[model samples]
Target: MNYSRRHLLQGSLAAGGSLAAFGDQHLAEELERKLRGRRPLGIVFCVSDGMSQGVLSMSEAFSQQVRSQGTVWWNLMSSQKAVMGLMDTASSSSLVTDSAAASSAWSGGQRIPNGKINVDEQGREIESLGETLEKSHLRLGLVSSATITHATPAAFAATVPNRGQEESIAEQYLNRVDVLLGGGSRFFDPKVRKDHQNLFEIFEKQNYQVIRTRNELLHSKSEKLLGTFSPGYLPYELDRKHDEELMKKIPSLAEMTEAALSRFLSSGDPFLMQMEGARIDHAAHQNDIGAILHEQLAFDDAVAKVLTLTAHREDILVILTSDHGNANPGLNGTGSSYRETNRSFSKVAEITRSTENFLSQCQQELRHSKLDLAEFFTSTYGFAPSANELDALMERLSGREVVEWSQQHKNSVGLLGQIVGNVTGVGWTGICHTADPTQLTSTGPGANQFAGLIRNDSVRDRLLRLLPI
Candidate 1:
């Protein structure tokens, strides 16, 4: 049955009115049964890329500290209405998985290599969920904080042997995806693209409203939209929050989520939309505690928006999960009997910028004039680094070898993270993807299919069952 706004509203009003008029218990029970039997008209899948168990816990704590409230995700897990599960995230080549294979497991229904998207180990092409949905005349939408052609989003709609082939992935989304909102404007701009192909013009010719600014996105009336806010991945939530001008130019993850989802909901189309908070993974890779927590919170805000928009509708299913774990950042016990734990964790709130922004400033300062590294660190992080820690950071930035046990932690960002972690009580297990199952939760119709420990490869089939073609 093709579910439309009229059909759904009429069914609901009729059932509700009849029950209210008759006031018979049997009539109410029959109405409930029929409502439960109806299939969903849409599905929204939210991804907090590279979020670990610790990230979720820290985000909850951070939200409580700043907003004086628990996070939406934490509340969802506490509630009885949502079904919770753990996703077994792995790849064909290794126990650890990158964004490409992890998402491919869900989109293509196969555990390919760590860096391939919808391509099997033998290089065979697998049909992606977006492609399959397109064939059924169902719409697909992708909203991400990463470049729109990044691994996680690309796995859903585009097939390529290597995840690095982003230009090709951008091309593939032309007709397959109905709503595309994120970063990576360079891939669409003819002047910046290597191929000099004007993707914006092409998409506009195909009836897509190409937008580049936050204002345009907010005012856009077109149902078919392609909005790119940055040349690459959008600025990290931590960085964007502190910059006044950048805040006006770029939309929040929640805003993008709303823009994509509202269009689908109003159109009354049976659709699949994927919303991603992509910066959490980048922050985790850098072992930046402040950035990671802020990114996770941004993702949580998007989750809250999703639940609110679908609250009254019984025809939308929402699933939230992470692709893989990275750096596994956790707050460690500090001081006698761990009494200092909260105070130590509180230091994260003082961080004014991401490590990436800090490093960029350091580079500019060092090149142009004398920069007191110690003073710079104190100003940005709200704490002065010790002489030895400052020396190590400077050496690492200069490409000098730092005697770090883990090869992944030998970089300048990792060194800075460790120095900051000393005060924040947070510790990271290197800077790379971990072999861990990710948290999963779902609500609305067919949510039970995600309960318990589910493998990533089973996601496509579960979604397909709910969305009959």
Candidate 2:
């Protein structure tokens, strides 16, 4: 249904009966709007799990270099239609928040300590947004590039004292969430679960069409669907893009977003859907510039999909934001007059694997000679490391300490990220979450509520105010 602003306001007024009880017309209208809500048909909450401000700009530049075009997020921000804001994120216990605490603040309307999902610092279980929406008969869906039961997605629906309880988080979603997509088949596979409870069979019995692999997801016509594409978190976009097998098996974040949204749009019901680009945080934690940029670009593609799908639908609001910032990555000037900066930054496009994958490969090929290791590094990173850099990396990989300025960069992944960054012009602060606020961009009906600075803990109330619950 096409709902005009005037029409909704008129309905609100009608629902309030006569406005005479209020002395002022402005007060009456405000009260009417508050009672009726913005009442969007659905809200698409898109999260780039740990995207800092620098990541957004880097992704835009990266897209221009590789895709021959700018990112959807860059275009959206430049357009007058988007409402911009910054989210003040934090946990009750610390200034720098973890994913579980940050996401819990958004879903539970309060800040808890780090490492807990929707559970307060005092060990009380707060009702998650999914549970509250379920009670109101509104459907909820979750999509991510991380484990389906990972912190970001789990916080929306599950209340657990410890965020590591993937099995418990998986069980909590059985009846509450209407649609589930993303990785973590191990949590659902009876063969892998410690208790050996077949979640797939249980979901099938509940009328959910359980599926795995990209082909099944695209072809299946089920309204209620459960799809898990990997045993753990999905592979990094850079790695997946280079692997034909992964391309055939794992669906992109945009594809999963489309599948989840299509189900809710077809139902024509009031719903809340969270689509996350989860691995951006993982890449950031490892200080992987190439992986983080590719991940952010993938997320921007998903944003484009959402905007295109909802272009003509006035009742669907799309909110794009992040939970927190991680290892703030930025491009630094290189050579005289910074002329070499672009040349250096352009080299990031040549990276073929995530630093995590690079480390994994190194572990498997530990016995290789230094010359063989140099060749492997050159093949994977598209640039050869200096002899001293290679020696330090080898030492770090072999569990020997290499003196580093930041204590955080002493690990293999951190050392490798810096070595690659020396060629790519990118630099990382450290290998952990930052206390900085994250970017927020919103569009569609009810987008104005998210304008200006938003507190993480206030997000739940703001979302509920716009939605009819």
Candidate 3:
């Protein structure tokens, strides 16, 4: 490999000395069994579902946007190079893998068909990583920016037919889980759906303090607290960051990660947690550049959370990665490969969310009319518009009829590029998932299993090998 990649792998594996015993992949299984009852194995697995290669690269390029001072996650991600691998993201049926199958590659340690979570076609059950950890002494927790029942987080703890069977999924949490945080209040509130089963009651009956607000999530006395902050996915980080009081009310992905760590750590035994930057997927689906960037910033905070707690633990294994690439966004280019227009992403939050929201609403017309919507957006979002630009817009719209794109437009980056393009004039491909292998970075105990290139399922197998249920 080249020097840049080598630096990334070495920096991420700085604690390689502790995991030297598992260097032999052939011996990985035996090493995992040896860890079954000995070490305090802590696994913090992150799934950046639908996280495009573009988003992955962009987040690193602009890590400081939502970065806070004293965040160890930043330091850990910056110099720590992860063992980067490209896994074939194909499912049993299609070239494009859905969230369930993508997640199963890691959760079940065996790839399943799309729409299934660790289950065979006959519905026979398979042991999940969460069940294995619970079989051991570790605590269990699941958090995400999307609904808790979302495929990635649910893969570890729950199983069901339709990934949309969230109503039923909420009921399953009535068992041994300690912390469940994220959006999906709709799944808990029976009123939101006829069959939601009013799971808030079940969680309460089981002694799980159902927390609805941020304060409740922070202060709940019950060891098992279920915090469902939003009915759907939480607001974009760009929008949330604009409001200080609003930002504090709903826990960011990082805050949820911190809460999960604190609550799980109380078990006196190292636990397992999964942190997801779900919006990166949503933004990709909508091709919303602003949403994708800000949520990524929010996710970086969660990375910081784990880094803080594990910086001292030489045995904890922290893995970072995305499932698949979506709407591959990139900075606009110019002559020869369009390299000149590349934008510097110091911090994604540096761009206001209103700008993002407005861009999504009206971009195509701006392109055809040569009317930089950025000016209209500037005035609408509180910046001033130039007289020349205002005249250009008026002249363009004066007598010309407008054409609208159809909803069937499937290319995500195309949609996103059109919107963000008109706003910022950045160029990118149409919205679509790239079959590229994702980057995998790891630290702490059992990390040797993450060296070099490996399959996505190899990640879970490595964790299972490390914990030895």
**Model 3 segments more than 4 A misplaced:** 1-40, 64-87, 121-123, 335-351, 354-376, 379-416, 422-425
Report the Cα lDDT for candidate 2: 0.90
Candidate 3 lowest-lDDT run of ten: 3-12
For the record, the alpha-carbon RMSD of candidate 2 to the native fold, in angstroms, is 4.3
Q: Model 2: what TM-score?
A: 0.94
Cα lDDT for residue 118, model 3?
73
Better of 1 and 2 by TM-score: 2
lDDT of 2 by residue, 395-452 (tens): 8888899989888887887898899989998999999999999999999877877888
Candidate number achieving the greatest TM-score relative to the actual structure: 2
So what's the TM-score on candidate 3?
0.78
Over 348-430, each residue of candidate 1 has an lDDT whose tens digit, in order, gives 99999899999989888888777789888998999998889988988877779888887778888888889999999999999
Candidate 1: deviation at residue 39, Å? 2.5
Per-model TM-score on C-alpha atoms: 0.92, 0.94, 0.78
> Quick one: how many clashes does candidate 3 have?
16
For each candidate in the order shown, give its overall lDDT on alpha carbons: 0.90, 0.90, 0.66
Model 1 alpha-carbon miss at residue 184, Å: 0.5
Backbone clashes for every candidate come to 0, 0, 16
